[model samples]
Target: HIVAAKYNIRYIISGGNFATEGILPKCWHYNAKDITYFKYIQKTFGNKKIKNFPLFGFLQEMYHKLVKKMKIIYLLNYIPYSKNEAMEILTNELDWRYYGGKHYESKYTGFIQSYYLFNKFAIDYRRATFASQICAGAVTRTQALKELEKPPYDESKAQLEKEYIAKKLGISLDEFEKIIHSPAKWYRHYPNNEKWLSFIYDTYRRLFKKEKLGNF
Candidate 1:
């Protein structure tokens, strides 16, 4: 029904969740052979013990192929750790210039490198974008192109012309994050705010905030 809505309609974009199960698809899935390749990277890069697949196969193939061709051996070694650790390092700063842990540790930061490969050179770019999330360093090349032809959601750029109660009430980013994270908080924090009531009645919001979250 939302898809059938006409021109100039506004919509909220949900974050691409990486959890194993949810309304969103699974974070990762790729070919079986690709898993073996990641294992190789794990051993050579971080010398860590890989417990499970970091991402699914379809997500892996795009960067995996590039890593193969470029002989990018460093990130492969860190495959033993969870995706969270890998992402933190990639998103944050890691000294790839000098190798402290291993000789190849400086080869590639997983997130940045993956973006470089996927955003720049995948054959089925749209398919790759749909398969992986941005935190995995996967940028949607096709979506970026489409936004060129149409108005893109200016989430980061959006300025509230009218002072929101949430903002005027002097809400901090952390507090706002907390409210959005849990259903209970929505009502608990903003009982007088009609938005919270509307959210509680909305079927989608009810489903999304079913569980009460204590921590992010």
Candidate 2:
């Protein structure tokens, strides 16, 4: 908001394509064009040294609840092509390279999402994503369940990635392992104004009709 005010940019546009994906499965697919658009937008208007703001982080998780019921067809307008189709087009026309998994372009992110989240927290995001695809008629439930049963990362590659990450962070592999084994903490563990924020949000919701408040 401060950045927008400084730049006199009135509209806060987001490619919130995941809004319909949450409620309906068929809208779950993402393609290379999505990545291209994101890169283009970032190059055009994104901050070079972005600070991690707590309010922005808080809003990311909470805002989805406000748009959970958005129609799938409307969201489809944002994603007109399939993943495979986009890949083919990008590879052929733009010589765009492919990374294996979601957010895998970043080594740290790839390690955390593919290895750390699963190994430490037992949280397999692939299961949820595959299940969503199943719901969207993109894949069979059996296929998704079978895929879930398999490990997310290859053991040899994961070890190499782990070593690379630990080295990059200037931490011993042993220390990294201990950190990974430590119990996970929730957002409430840190100091924040979420309670007051929630209270105010709820009060506003109560003053207005539920539908008007986008609570559905």
Candidate 3:
């Protein structure tokens, strides 16, 4: 209680009931993920014995369902890049590793904020591009021609890229354009700031609200 209280947690759920009685603990981190705290959780509850309660896995399953149901209104793309050549490979493969393995790594350093919201951001990106394309296309012929002839990734090319990305996400091009865009949806608000720590804290705030953090 003291430890949890120090972290401003409201209550502590024990794992003895889960392991011994076949109950499962709630996925509290569904609202937020804190590495140092969950490290403590792994230390404390990771080794508890499992029993045969039918509801043991209920909490996590329910949490997943809730997550799928909640609409993600905002999205931001915080693509990390650098002029340094050696960092390119790392940035290139980041998306794959993020959605797959190394997901838990985000919790450790709060580095996964972009990654965690990326699945949604990708969908939004396609949509926003679609809208931008339509707006750009409806312009005068001269402007349209100019857009078409623009650089390697100009408006037209970007539009096609958006369509391709939408297809990859299994969302129609129309769905992409109709959604809203807000600054809140952006993941990389201040990239030039300190060592990504400010972004991490902002992502945390977005995930759990400005009120408080949860207990493990």
TM-score of each: 0.18, 0.63, 0.20
Residue 96 in model 2: lDDT: 92
| RMSD per model, one decimal | 24.4, 10.1, 20.0
lDDT: worst 10-residue window of model 3: 15-24
Per-residue lDDT of candidate 3, residues 159-207 (tens digit): 5645665575567877655531322233123122223434555665678
Residue-level lDDT of model 2, residues 101-121, one tens digit each, is 756889888888778988876
Number of the predicted model whose lDDT against the real structure is largest: 2
- True lDDT of residue 52, candidate 1: 57
Tell me the deviation in Å of residue 42 in model 1: 1.2
Question: Please, what's the RMSD in Å of model 2?
Answer: 10.1
Identify the runs in model 1 with alpha carbons over 4 angstroms from their true place. Answer: 1-29, 32-35, 49-114, 119-145, 148-216
Best by TM-score: 2
- Evaluated against the true structure, the overall lDDT of model 2 is 0.58
Worst 10 residues of 1 by lDDT: 20-29
Candidate 2 ranges beyond 4 A from true positions: 1-6, 19-81, 203-216
